[model samples]
Target: MGWFSNAPTANRIQNTNTIAACVALLEANGQVLNEVNTFASNQINRGQQLSAQAFSVQGAGSQLGRELQAAIGSLGALKTNTSQQLDELGQLCHNMELLIQQFDVPRGARTINASGRDIARVAVHDTSLVLANLLVLEQNSRPDIVRSVQTIDRADTVLNQGNANQAGLNLPGMNFRFQ
Candidate 1:
């Protein structure tokens, strides 16, 4: 059921198989992180375009423009956070791969003790499952997030085109962040 649960059911082969399963999960996690980064980059690009439009308009000093600027600032923060997450994920995957390699190699230069290996096995088993679940949730919710950003773009377009009375209707403040 979990990411490291692909190992053998029998006790004799459990240790080696569990290490293999952890390596598999870490590899899959790298792929998943790449996908997440692509989606995040697209969103950041959209925000950049919107920000430029907001700055270029004649109504740049208007309340709408200010709000849009703030929203885009938030988007910038999201981009920064996304970048940090990518770095962390990369480091984590690299460390885990190294650990897995060391665990499998006997008389290797970077060898971990038996107790350390046991602890790592438990940690990777639990945490990898949690990470996989969160990635799935993020993937499932991405479409909705993209559509919502598109809706915001359309609203900005209408405001810029003077199709709506910006003075009469107030745009509600909205904040979006990924947990």
Candidate 2:
């Protein structure tokens, strides 16, 4: 005969389900974090491009020149926001990972009581919330960057027009173009 009753089996099943759910949540969070990181990198690259263009047209005091400056400023703002959001996401991920590790600790017996079940339930809930928040942050940050980039492009277009008109006057282009 088995040393324990069917209660142990039930507890084992519950524990298994809890662990599975937590692992799934963690994996989803990981994917979102990766996407956020990729988006942040692209934002940085775009910011750098805007900065370089601004520097190229630094001396020319025209509407297009001012537009270029504004574009650079917007990009700087986006970078700052993205960096802050990423830091928060990283911290959340770290905390979730630690919680999962704690759940994975070996138990003395298979008879999971109410306390163990409660802990597992709480961990699962926390992980889900973290994942949700991460997704929301990523979605919000993306659109902000997109809007900023669009503005920058519009400014660049106006600046390019100025560059074309000033071709004969030897005014600097928005960027250094070796002709």
Q: What is the C-alpha RMSD of each candidate to the true structure, in Å?
A: 8.9, 11.1
| lDDT (Cα, tens digit) per residue for candidate 1, span 1-179 | 22223333354256656656665655555565555446545655655555566667645675544555555555445445445655666666677666666554442334554433473676466546546544654555444444445544655565456542221122211112212
TM-score of 1: 0.57
lDDT of each: 0.51, 0.51
TM-score, per-candidate, Cα-based: 0.57, 0.55
**Pairs of residues clashing in candidate 2:** none
Summing lDDT over every window of 10 consecutive residues in candidate 2, give the lowest-scoring window: 170-179
Model 2 segments beyond 4 Å from truth? 1-8, 58-114, 152-179
Q: Largest lDDT belongs to which candidate? A: 2
The parts of candidate 1 lying over 4 Å away from their true place are 1-12, 107-110, 115-151, 159-179
Q: What would you estimate as the lDDT of candidate 2? A: 0.51
